[model samples]
Target: MRLVVDLNRCQGYAQCAFLAPDVFAMHGEEGLLYTPEADEAQREKLAQAAAACPVQAILVDAVDPPAEAVSGER
Candidate 1:
């Protein structure tokens, strides 16, 4: 999964950080940082963070399940 944050649209609201500190954070008072490539385990938190964004600047890209999982090999 991939996460995209539009800095131009973000207002440092810190909501994303609050919702998913593992994937998102605020740098000081004027900066925001996030994991561009997030693990599948973070999907739920990422979705919550995206929804919590007042400016809707966070974007989460859907990732396909692992081949083994998809094929039910495990």
Candidate 2:
């Protein structure tokens, strides 16, 4: 599965980091570290992490924009 974290909107809540340590982590202060791609086995955890994000910044499985959405093409 794929994942995307909107770092710009993230608030360093650390909820995701606590929920899915394998996929998400806390950096020095407010930065976050995460894996873009995760194992299918981690789907449930990913969901929990995404939901736990206070700012709703995590987008799992939609990391890659759709073909027509890329570069605003039709």
User: lDDT at 18 for candidate 1?
Assistant: 88
lDDT (C-alpha) at residue 47 in model 2: 97
Mark the regions of model 1 whose C-alpha exceeds 4 Å error after superposition. 62-74
Tens digit of per-residue lDDT, candidate 2, span 1-74: 88889889999999999899999989999889999989988989999999888899999865544566557544
> Which pairs clash in model 2?
none
Quickly count the clashes in candidate 2.
0
lDDT of 2 at 39: 90
Tell me which residue pairs clash in candidate 1.
Answer: none
Model 1, span 1-74: residue lDDT tens: 87789999999999888888998888999699898988878888889999989999987766553465556555
